[model samples]
Target: MTTPVQLYVYDLSNGLAKRLSLSLTGKQIDGIWHTSVVVFGREIFYGQGILETRPGQSHHGKPLHMIDIGETAIDEDTFNEYLAEISQHYTADKYHLLDFNCNSFTNDVIGFLTGGSIPSWIKDLPSDFLSTPFGAALRPTIDNMFRRPIPGAAPTPATLQPSPAATQAAVNASPNPALAASLLQAVASQAFSPSASVNGTGSSAPAPATQPQTSSSTSTVSAPVHICTNPSSFHSLLRSHRAVIAMFTSATCGPCRMIEPVFEDLAWSKTHGVGKDRVAFVKIDMGVGLGSQVASEFSVRVTPTFLFLLDEQKTYEFKGADSSELRSQTDLLLFQAFPPHPHTKLSFPAVEALSSEPILFTQVPALDSVISKLASFVDGSSSPSETVAAKEKLSQSFPVYLKARFPANKGAQPPKNLSANPQLIASWAEATRTIASVLPAAQLFPLVDLWRLSLLDQPIATWCSAATSQTNPVHIFMSKAIDALHTADMSARNTVLVTLRLLANATSNTALVRSLLSAAGHRAETTKVLVSSLLHADASVRTAAASLAFNVAAYLQKGRMDRLRGDSSAAGMEVEEDGDWEVELVSAVLEALSNETHSEEVGTSFRAAA
Candidate 1:
């Protein structure tokens, strides 16, 4: 799997670059000039002055150091937005020669990403200058340069980097006493600076400082409490979440309005502490047309009534504007939900984005040519006999080919040179798509065996950027395919699990993620199947499930924060309840991670993911 975190460091001539005027003529400076964080090799996260973290392009110098900060908990969208929020103060327009520069931005980003920061030297560079006699004398010139954005740099009003949702870095350093002592001595030796002793990258000398300097991570955003107008929809919300506190009141009721703000605040998704469940707080205006009917259904006769629902069933109800009673019932709601899931909680954005980038099919004939062979079955222009024969031929021959290619021989391997066969991983994906497009469970099952074989392992189950195939027909048809798999024979069921596992790791494209999300109508049941498969009796199936857990968790962490901030584009995303499929999936993963009875690989994976 690709590393989720990397350090993109750039040295502006190590204190002797284009801004030399500020360094030499203005203030004495030490260490490098700029640095940034890169996540999933997909985006460059750095402070550029003003608010815009340069999108995907990297104009900065080659990274001097690329540290693997393990898999990050936050996704790119969240990190980017965090940068946007941080610009409130860390604007490029306010760039300081020594004080708040690119270094500070990097520190803040590291904090957000891994709950760590660069060593003190990198962070306290300005402090170093301020402490010196000459530093105080040159403050004006340095501050002037900082206040003035470099001519070619970001225009005024650009800013970024914020502190939020963080914990101490989990980077593991070797436990060598000498190394530890030397590191302490090194810090002591650098007596000039007490603010920070780690290297510019937060690495300790004579030792790779794997431990990221700790920093506070608190997100300033979360999904707002929503309004429910429809009665059935509100009931569904109650049933769907672990705890839902519905505020029932009419427009004519004064207490409802008085308690409105408080309800909104309490309903907010962020509770400011670890694992606090964000209750579903909803308001029902009974004075409206549907309110009275809803009131009758819930048997509410009083104004300012609060209904505490646990698992779609109401366990408690409060009447009147007594805020104390309302809060007490909410507390009872949490108490029943119980167990207090700290980190291993339902994060819906992560659930929604649990997909690999689809491998874009950019090649022309390579992609189309393969589909050409099977497209005939879909169009029905071919004679029924021809179609039947083609299916049988594929069913019989493809699996044999896969077995030969991957070889059951444990020590056997695919050719050093790649396959030129049409079933080369590239053509296989096209074939899978063609079969899926051909439609009808009866027709597709014939080839499911072959498809399943392709997913077994090795050089078989995979794809390459074979053509301009951005969309996977399988992804689009996944729901139906999964539904079909459920009723199929044991082999077919196993095959689907294996194929999904392969897809999770095999493609570099997001087509899979897109398909899963777009077909969200089917996600609940589908998620259930996958989560259940994690504990299947089949060892291979369990292995596949575990791998998928990693992928799902990684993908989820990348996009969660943005979704929580109520990004309009992510409007309908909802966190699953305690027993919900998504919640079960996360809990299963966390359990597997903590389960010492399991294999080392699973335990290690969960620990890393954590």
Candidate 2:
């Protein structure tokens, strides 16, 4: 049964936007759009993650307009499955007013359900807001409004609104087990947050994207907290940070001036785990004002003095201008603050040397052939001829967009924004979903090949790499390929080869890689595919399988190394699961190596995996 899909659009400004937008932004905006998809007897939206309510029953009240974009053949159970997959990405913390908002979520959902999009006037509002002087000026304010709560301000009505999933046990749980473990350790040691409860949630939203400029610091680059004239502010910093590295200096001190830059650089070094809420670097100018009072309290008499505090207790103090010593002591403090996994102490030189670059099969086939093959697949399906037209449109326009965005010259830099025509994006997404669903596993190579090339581009990769997308073409395609691998057919073998290449390209997104590998059933199926394909009769299949193994191994190896260095960025899998993964991967590689004879290429790839 085809279910009707309606786009329920609400004006967030309550009709004030139409009255004031022109004066404020120098643009005549229709309304501030807050949209939801109404389908399968429910109104679905993204706010505090994926939410659903009875049609016309949401707290937003009745929508200003509801457009019947189209209908979807997707059943209720399948749609729920889709929701479960995409929910993690659409958390309340991830929501933003500009870069990714309710409209973005609706657009993704609409594209999946009906192969259509939300109205352009609604979809283009964020960009339209950004194009104006007032809007551009307010970008930071808008971001901060959503990113963090104002200090000491009363909670707003929106903040107090209960999530629909508040009753769910996992609502308060950390998605990643390793992260939860780290949090527990930090809480137990009273190093991370002394007052923070084990179940508490804090604002760790990513900083908003800045407008294009000659230079701008990214969200990862953090500035040191300064306590130039305030002695009281130092205590707050000490309470908040797990470890505080305070540099006490005076303006007149020559050595103090020399080491200020070094202190600032340490705060910005992401490799040192400087950013986020993990560690804080402070600069205190004690030459004048209450800075002298702070200096007196700490009994700092030297021109350049360093104080290292863990959980507000002084662990180390030094009086000098030694840059190397500063770095070494900072590293030591962080190591104590965040101890490494025991696995880091073990040796794995071969895994250490493996290339981390994703093995992308970038060879673009003749466009005419690829498109014609795709058209044939569409023709075989129950889809309309327009589906073929959409597929052709994507095949022609996507490559052009990629070329314009990423030129052949090594020095060329594309705009950070992946602002292709919305129609092209919609068509590409619809076509991918259609092809993956209708095409048999044996005949999936051409579409898989195109997808592999598409993943090389940032926009497509970003969209597809989400473990659960509106359409989830990548996950669906991967599942299909893995299932087909159990068969002995030659065509299945061919499909698996291309599928492995596609998997390799997916490794470019670390989060996506972790998401795919972390699922127990998916990981088991993938292991079976790799093990069987490694021993396949065809050398190409074996080589492709080996290449995929290398990518997965490299990813796991890097995660292990990150943990060793006290970098929590790659912490996702549980400790036991991570150990099991290494053992299983190594066993597969050894099993394949024992039977290898026909091709040295396969051996080399397997050796890389080993």
Candidate with top lDDT is: 2
The residue ranges of model 2 lying beyond 4 angstroms of the native Cα positions read: 1-243, 247-265, 270-305, 310-315, 318-356, 380-396, 399-423, 486-490, 509-532, 535-537, 562-577
Q: Report the Cα lDDT for candidate 1.
A: 0.45
lDDT of 2 by residue, 78-162 (tens): 7776565444344444455555566666766675566566776885576566544334334444444343253222223344322
- Candidate 1, residues 1-610, lDDT tens digits: the string is 2337665555545333233322121223444445556664443332333222232234443555665655666666665565544444343233443544555455545555665555554544544433322233333433332232233233222211111111000001111213322332332122111121223353333311121111111111112343443454465445445777778876456676677666756654233222233346666656542456667899999888988877778898878788777767766676666544355466668535544332121111222233344444455644354454544444445554655555656688766653333234444455455445445543443344344334334223212211222323234334444564466445445445544554454333232232232222224534654565555555555555666566655555434543434332222222222245556677776765554464666555444444
Q: Clashing pairs in model 2? A: none
TM-score to true structure, per model = 0.27, 0.51
Note the Cα lDDT for every prediction shown. Answer: 0.45, 0.61
Q: CA shift at 156, candidate 1, in angstroms?
A: 36
What is the clash count of model 2?
0
